[model samples]
Every structure is written in structure tokens, then in C-alpha cells.
Target: MSARFGRLRRVLAVLLTAVACQSPPAVRAAAPPGPAARASGVVTWAASADRMGEGTAGQGYRLVVHTSVGGSDLRVRFTNAFGDRPLTLDGVYAGLRARGAALRPGSNRPLTFGGARTVTVPAGAVAWSDPLPGRIPAGTDLVVSLHTPDAAGPATGHWMAMQTSYTGRGGHTAEESGANWTQTTGSWWYIDSVAVRPSRAARGAVVALGDSITDGWHSTTDLDRRWPDYLARRLHAAGAPVQGVADEGISGNQVLADGAGQAALHRLDRDVLSQPGVRTVFLFEGVNDIKAHTGVTAAELVDGYREIARRAHAAGVCVVAATVAPFKGWPEWDPAAEAVRQEVNRFLRGSPDFDAVTDFDRVLRSPYDPERILPFFDGGDHLHPDDKGMQAMADAVDLDSLDCAR
Candidate 1:
């Protein structure tokens, strides 16, 4: 009995010694949740495959948010605030490339929605990233592979602002969704919300809303010289990460009635009020109404603008009204149209309804002749400002009103 007991003790001792001497098995943990962590020295911008800015037809595309400020226990967000149909995801994976080859040995992971592996966002909705493991540090180029589950239609992209990260500000409720009737009707529609990220010391965003001018009609492509782009560039240059800009312009949009887009009132609640981090709203419109919708008189257009300002102010947004520019030689230009344009300009120059004003007309109209666009600034249409003309329009904005840091 004593011999047996000694042998049993020896075997137990051997097993314990081996366990202590040998290396332990590696352990992995569930990723934790927290605020967006900073991935230092990173510049994150949104983009899809195939086109630098435009997504392709039929084939699915992924918009990558490059993170310069990376940190641990991190997660990501995907968007479809501009999609027309339900965006179904096939599989989501993360990857890092070295000289166009996979850098991180295991760069793929299944993405989940509402904490599950797959998600479907209805038109105008966005989905967020589940907590991903480990850390995505500075200089890490992470790509999310998104597959569209169905055949898609002709796509249009929001072209004005050069955005950094494409953020998901959650879904638009029925009340919010109902405001954009043009989107619901579906002739052609774009984004509905102002995407902004949470920044240190309380982040805020400025919303720029208007028609083609705000859409940057004649501005050179990839130059990113849109007024809002200039504004954001100025802000960022000034180290004003606290404030961002959201360009909500839709080509052919008007203040009083529907045209290429729903009337300004039809979109105000969603584009202006429901926007995330929107601290200020720059309402630059009325040219289209003056040129195309002649049924509404100058007085009516002025009052309509006043109502827009009223609505914005009621919602606590600082409103800046822009004076209409000279459109005397546009193909659609007529003496009656010019009169309405002049009358509308008169209201903007001296309107007490807005919190402040920007004289875009003063900047683009030739010094020698106030009614005619400077020969250099005309896009030959007479109505739309050329590149220089657009820049002049941007310069007309009251930088102080923007209160942007840079």
C-alpha cells in the first residue's frame, strides 16, 4: 500500500512539473466596445472599388474608410444613406496589403449586423461595425469587402464635398424619411443625412444646402474646390476637428417648388434638421426658381426664403442667406427672369429674416457691370458660374459665420 501511494504521488508530481515547465496555450478574448479610438497619424477617406468616386453598375463596391487614428478594441461603420434599393451583404472581410499582397497573415473576418454575421440596410439606411479584435494602429490600410446581393440600377454619387470618413448616423425614422418626397417617388435621389463622427471636446458639423452651385457644377473634378470643400479645408487647416462640413446640395434643387429635386421645404427637415452634428446651415438657393419656375414672383420667392430661414431658426440652426447672382445671359434667361433674380437679390442683401448674409452676387457680378457675369467666370450658360465664379461664390461666405477653426 505504501509503495503504491509513492508511485501515485510521483506520477502526479511529474504531470504538475510538465505543465509548469511547458508554455501555456495562447488565449483570445472577446473584443470590447468603446468610443472611436484615435489611430494616430492617419487620414481616413471613403471610397468604392472600380471608380475613384463613382460606384459601378451590376458589380458591387465597397467604400473604404482609411483610419489614420487607429486604436484597440475597434469597430467600423458602413453606409447606404444614398442607396435606392435594399443593400444586402454577401460577406464582409478586412484585409491589409503589402506591395499589393496580403500583409497581415489572417486579414479576413466575418462582419456582423445587429451582432450577427450578415445585414441588410433598406434604402437610405446605414449599418455599423461589430467590435473587431486586437488593434488597428496608425498607417494601417484596412479594407472592408462588401458584396451587393442583387443587380443594381444606374448609380449617382454626391459630388460636392470631399469627405474624410463616411459615418453611419443611424437610420431615418418615418418622420424624418417622409420629408424627402423626391426620394420616396424615386425619379432620382441621393443621400439624406449629414454624416459626422464623435470627436473630442464635442464634435459639430456645418450643413451646406443648395442647388447646382452648391453641387459645384463647373468646379474642376478631383480638385475638391467646392465652397464647402474650401470651408472644410480651411477648418481642418486651422485644426478645427471639432467642426465639420456636410454638403447637402442636390443639382436643380429650388427653394419654393419641386424641380430636379423636391422643393426646399420638402427636404429641409431631413437635410437640415435631421443631419448629424449640424451646428450651422448655409441656405444658398433661389436661382433655379427664378429661372425655371416663373409662376412664383420675386415677392413670393422672398417670402418663401423667409419661411426657410424661420424653419431653420426654429430648429436652432444659424442661417446664412446668399444673394442671387446675375444670370442675364443664360440660355433660359429672359427679361422677366432677370427681374425676379434682381428682386430676390434685393431681399438677400437686406433681409432681416436670416441670422446673417453672404453676398455671392457681389462676388460673381463684374465690377463694371453688376447684371452680367464677368466674361472669365461664365460657363457660357450665363446662369451657372465657372470654376473661378464658383470660388468667388465660396469666398462670399462669411467665414466668421462659419466659425470653423481653420
Candidate 2:
């Protein structure tokens, strides 16, 4: 028994040392600083988390995400929220994408956590990298390369990214040229959020929470034609106060159920509320639940919206609800479903629970058939909007509505 205890003590000591050595620099920097502290900025890009189908043990992923707001001192957030074991990321790099998997020369820079090159996020936890010194422009394609030496169990990532990313194997390729990243993928893995210290003139952020439409399903791949993307561009062009845009949409997701991903209600805290400098929550989901015909009534759906608004208001964030768009020709469309959509839109437009309302139904519906989508806007399948339709949706948004006092 004495011998066994001694061995256990030695193992424990070694593990403790390893963890101490791997502590991120941010952990140490948390100490009270002198009076000249820098002001923090809001999250400029984010994607809702969906189940990671499978995780590779010795692989790397180089994800390309477009920024919605430009700022300096960029930082990235990684999640292992669904993994069952600690996920170790040994190498991570951030750079501006030139094309394909290639990054602009001299733009790629190594990222460290707590001053260490490696970080091990425990199951169901998230870690934010220490801010990298540099300026990332709005609308720029930022490529994040990460290599995980040991990863398994369920991974946490955003599927149906719409944009193309690359993956590689063998040793860490985070700093190398894109030549080695031959495999292409349409999903963004591990990394979920990116933030920066914006200029004083820039305001906070708005998060778009919804299903497939908000997820940019029918929009052209790699084009960033999603409605939220369009909205971001508009904000930048107009110099709107709300400059940051986080699209927290998941394809096939619902407002009240976990079928496609964690329901909006379940993920609201992580995907919407927790983000820094988030001033408004744009709720634009519910078609899936109504069409699924799971007996979810209009009243029940309204209850979900009310709950979202209540939570957002409690957190001092404004709520902007969008009416569900017309979907007459969708396979699941029926009289009952149409009735629910209409009723929900009516409630959304009239509800005092929301700080503002955007009538997407009025914008996308055909005049001839109120329940049907306009032919010009339909992305075939009569559900999601095409690139033009996406632009229209963004145009319908009143930029001023997004700038709430909170």
C-alpha cells in the first residue's frame, strides 16, 4: 500500500506540473494593472454550435471566417463544449487568407494561451486565446489554423458553414503555407468566436439567432451572401453604430426543440448572451418547428419568443424579432402550418416584448399568394432565399433598430 501511494503521488505531481506549465498567458495577465487599461471590444464573428459528427485524433483544420467588423488586438475563442475528454490543441495560427488555403505572406502569426503554446480545454468548457497584436479589417477573410495532437469523442463545431475550409494531417501545419492543406471541408470546427478591440467610434454587436435561412443554406457557397453577411456590409457602409454581427444560426435548427441542434432556448446563453459587447438579439427562427407539425401551436411558439425576449431583456440586451418568411411550396407546408406562421408573424409584429420588429414575411411573400415566396427571391425549394433575396432581407432591416441603448 505504501509503494502504491508513493507512485500515485508522483503521477499527480507530474500532472499538476504539466497543467501549470500549460496555463495561458491571460491567466497571469488577469492581475490588476495600472490606470492605463485598454478598452475591450465586442465579438465580431460567431457561429452557433452543433454536434461534431466525429473528431480526428491526429489532424489539423484551417478554417476561413469572414469578419463583420474591423478592429485591433484580435482574439479567438475555441470550444470543446461537446467533447467527453480534454481536447489538446498544440498549435494554432491566425492569418489573412489570400486564396484557397493559402494565407498572405507575413500575415500568419502564432497564438498562445496563458503564455503557453498549447492549451487543453476540459470537456464542456471553452478557452480564449490571449489577444494577438494586429489589425484585422472588416470583411476580411481570416484563416485560423489549429492542430490537435489528441482529440476524440464528440467535437463541437458549426456544420454547414457555407464557406469552404481546409484540413491537413501529420504534424502541426498551422504556420506553413496552404500547399499542405489539400483536403477541403464545408464546416468550421472547434473555434466558435473571434473578437477585437474596435475603434472608439464603433458601437457594439447584434446576434442573428435562427434556423436554416439565417444559416445561409441556399446562399452561394463561399460567397458570404447570407443575409447577416449582407447586413454587416450595410452596417459598415452606412457607418452604423452596430458594427459587429454574429450569425448564431444552425441549419434545420428550431426555436424550441433540439432536433437539428440544441434548441434556440438551450443555446441562447452560450450562442447569444455570453458574447461580449452584444447589445441586441435578433430572433428569426421558427419555420422548422411549425412545418415539423410536432403539434407546436402558434401560442407555444409565441411563448418561446417571449422567453427569448425575457432572457435577453434581463441581460440588458434588446430583442428584434423577424417574421417567418413565406414557404407555401415547401414539402412540409400545409394549411395548419401556414396558419401557425401567419399567427406567429402577426404576434411578432405586434408584440411589445420585442424592442423592434422586421417583417420578413411581408418582404419575401408573393403578392399573388400571401403564403408563397416571391419567385424572384426563392432559392428553389421555396424556403431559403437566394443571394438577391438575402440582400433584400438585409435591406429590409432598419439599421437604427439594431442600435439599442443597452
Candidate 3:
């Protein structure tokens, strides 16, 4: 019996030794709930993607975007909305911009999807990166690096990004220095929305939806000088409840036509309603539609405005309409177009279709000639505003008007 007991003890000892010698089981803390699970963040930055443009095979894009409403848990949304084939992004990194293509060394961090290093976005679908753990400041120049091994068949992207972004070819350049990013492009690919977890004090965000003026066409490139940019600064300075500002303007965009990108009426749902935490929609389009000589009537434009307001209100977003700015000196200007512009402005100012109205016409038109853009404000073309004009337009906004309860 003693010998049998000794053998049993030896066996138990050997088992214990084996277990002790083996590697310990990995201990993983429970993952916090996703951002969608928590209702704390708002979209700080966004650009409207009109359609799928041409894309390079096995290329990388280092997109630079501006942010509003500082907060933690930065998240990015990539769109393959118009793609005909699957878009596979093998590497994606978000970092603070040190300059043009360079990033602030320690700021660059990898983003994951379901704990995966790579994410394949299906055609006509959007993908949100897992929340990155850290705080991002307001008005930050965020640089997002993305590389895809197989990107073909109408790549999804924004065509006219006023700011310059970098591009590269071959391997995963997302993790390397910007030195490999040799090519320069003035467009943003894949990336559409960037959201951040804001403090409870934040009210919500507002999207500025318009045309070239709203897209910052004449404003200095690489400089956040758009009226929306200026408005963001004003909101921050005033400590307004509405902190986040999304510029959803597309160059040459019209409210009634689909010529220069999708019309505002057609793209409203994607550009304005689908945005996260959007409390208000700042409507400042229609100039292009009127100027295009498409015979779009004032009543038709008014109806379009009403439809936009109806849709926005249904989505619990307030609508603030701006009267079209003066453009008498623009080559497209004619007596008929001028009549339409005036009639439209009259309806926009007096109509109850909008929650509130900002008379951008009053702010931008010359006192001497109500139909003409103020000489100082015009960016040589009389259609788009210069930097000073952009600032003035932003200054004209009533910060209180942006804060909506819903």
C-alpha cells in the first residue's frame, strides 16, 4: 500500500511539474462595449462622396482631414458605396499630421475591425473601424493612411478635396515614413466620416451642405479657411453646445441637378441625414442650379428646399437655410438667372419651410449693388468667396441657432 501511494504521489508531482513548465493561459480583459453600444460620440469630420472614381490597383492613400469637437475614442468610416468589387484594406493607420504627409511619430496607431488587422469592405457598403483608445483634439489635422492590395472597378472616393493628400504604390506604406508617399493628390479616397467620443456637455453636430463656396474652392489649399472652418473656430471660442462641424459641400454641386456630383436633393440622405449626431443641416446651395441655365424655376427650387427641410426634420435635424450670395459678375449671370436668384432668395428669407434663415445674400452682396458680390469678398470669379469673405460668412452665423434639442 505504501509503494502504491508513493507511485500515485510521483504521478501527481509529474503532472504538476508539466503544468508548471507549460505556458500560462492568456488572460484577456473583457472588451469594453463598442462605440455604437455607447451613445457618447458625434461625427467631428465628414466629406460627401459623390460616386466611384478611378482608383489605382495596389495603391495607398494618406488622406488628411480636419476635425472639430475634441474627444476620445477616434473612429473612421470608409465607404465603398459606389464600388463594383470588394475593397480590401490590409493596413490603416490614423495619426496626427506633423506636416504634409508626415505624421507625429507616436500619434500613428493601427485601427482594427473585430480584432482583425485587415478589413474587406463590400461593394456599396460602409465600414467603421473599431474605436481607437485615446483622445483627439478639436481642429486637428488628422492624417489617415490606407493601403489596399486589391482595389479595382470604380474605387470609391471624393473627387475635389481642397486639401492636398498623399499617395503611394506597392506594399503597406501606412506603417512607414511619409518619404515613400511620393505622389500628391487633391482628393480623399475611401474615408468619408470621422467621429470622436465627446463629453456629455457637447450638444451635437451640424453639416454645411452646399456648392463650391461651401467646399472652400477659392480658399487657400491645405489651410482650413472654409466658412465652415471659421465657424468651427467661432463655435469653439464661444463655447457653443454645437461643437462638431461637418463640411459636406461638393464643388459645383447644385440643389436641383446632378451635373457636378449628385444634386443636393439626391445626396441629402447620404451627406446630411446619415451623419452621426447631426442636430442641424445648414443649407447654402442652389446657386449652381440657378446659374446653370437649366431653366429651373423659383417654385421648383422652393419645392426642393421644402423637400430637404421635410427630410431633415423627419430625421430630427433642424434646417437652417441661407439665401444665395450675389453673383452678378459671374459669366453665367444673365437677366433670367438674376430674376430666378432674386425670387429664390425672397422665398428662402420669408418661407417658413426652414427652421431659421441666415441672409448670406445680405452678408455677401455689395451695399451699392445688391445683385453683385462685394468686390473685396469676391475671389476674382465673383462666384466663390475669398478668405476674408469666408470668414465674414462664418462670423455671420448665430451660434445659438445651431443648438437644436432633438
Measured by TM-score, the strongest candidate is: 2
In what order do the candidates fall by TM-score, top score first?
Answer: 2, 3, 1
TM-score of 2: 0.90
lDDT of 2 by residue, 147-187 (tens): 88888877878877878899999655556477789987778
Positional deviation of 19 in candidate 3, in angstroms? 71
User: How accurate locally, in lDDT, is each candidate?
Assistant: 0.53, 0.84, 0.81
Worst 10 residues of 3 by lDDT: 24-33
Predicted structure 3, TM vs. truth: 0.89
Off by over 4 Å in 3: 1-40, 174-176
Where model 2 places Cα greater than 4 Å from the true spot, the runs are 1-40
- What global local distance difference test value does model 1 have? 0.53
Quote model 1's TM-score: 0.64
Give the per-residue Cα lDDT of candidate 2 at 239. Answer: 88
TM-scores, one per candidate: 0.64, 0.90, 0.89
Q: Which is better, 1 or 3, measured by lDDT?
A: 3
Best candidate according to lDDT:
2
Model with the higher lDDT, candidate 1 or 2:
2
lDDT per residue (tens digit) for residues 176-272 in model 1: 1112112111111121221323335325556777876776555553355566656655555455442456566756667876535446766676455
